[model samples]
Target: MSTLDQDLASQIERLRAEGCEIIRSEKVSGASRDGRGELEIVLQFLRSGDELVVARLDRLGRDTRDVLNIIHECESRGAFVTVLDPHVTTRGEMGHVILTVLGMVAQMERRFIKERQKDGIERAKASGRYLGGKRRIDRHVVRELLAQGQSVAAAARTLGCSRMQIYRIIGEAPPAV
Candidate 1:
């Protein structure tokens, strides 16, 4: 069998050995996307003894707040969460503590990434090499559209952009001939 099949078979084997019955197994389809189908299944079907199993904690959420909220919501409904790869789960007191620490680390990591990105942008600007982001709507096109009596909102809609972009283009465009 394939690696995924083998892994799933083993998980089923382990869960069954631990006296747990498998009711349904589902796949979450996207990275950092809401697992709508998986969540609906859990909230709709899980009983008091049921465990919501995932391959990893990140599968449950993109950050600490999201993960904690998911855990709280599951627990409030009398269901527990089980993460398999490292065996961290919401099934015990110690698991909660570990999960909390891991979640905090994830949140801090995200903050650090954003700060690094901002620092990089500032350095680029200081070096006189930063020319802002690529223009979404061409200023010439915006000016032509405006000269043709198009409204700012209409120009934004035509350009698949926002009013802010239209306003910026207006500020940059030279006087009409």
Candidate 2:
């Protein structure tokens, strides 16, 4: 198994040993809830006595508001959430307080990470070691295709880019045709 899969398996085994009966996992980023189908399923399936457990608070979300919203949702449904790493649960008032603090810390940490990354990029650029992202489509090829009388849509299709990119390359607004 891949390293991520192996880590997940180990986490599952630990939770199982901890008496967790139902477990769900997803490899998607926890930055937002936009594409977390497994999390949604668990939230929807929660009952009065059900407990939602995650390996860590960050596993729930990186945004403080999103994490609090999730905890609130679970509480409103009479379900509890547990974080294994810090061993906190919504079974008591203290847990809520601690979770709120932890959520804020996680959000702050994300911001700090972004700041550090920006600083590193600045340093690399100053040293002439950082080039921007690799080019995905050749501007010359796009121009040649358009010069051959291809439609904006057709040129975009041929170059695997957007029609707007083709329009930009040709420096003209889209024709009414």
Question: Backbone clash tally for model 2?
Answer: 0
**The candidate that achieves the highest TM-score relative to the unseen native structure:** 2
User: 61-81 in candidate 2: lDDT tens per residue?
Assistant: 999999999999999999999
Candidate 1 lDDT over residue span 1-177, tens digit each? 898778667767766665666545555532343656756666677678667876656556647877888788789889898877578888889999988887777677777888999999999999998899886667888888999999999999999999997887777748568
Report, for every candidate in turn, its global Cα lDDT versus the true structure.
0.75, 0.89
The TM-scores, one per candidate, come to 0.60, 0.76
The reply for model 1, stretches above 4 Å from the true place, is 1-63, 171-177
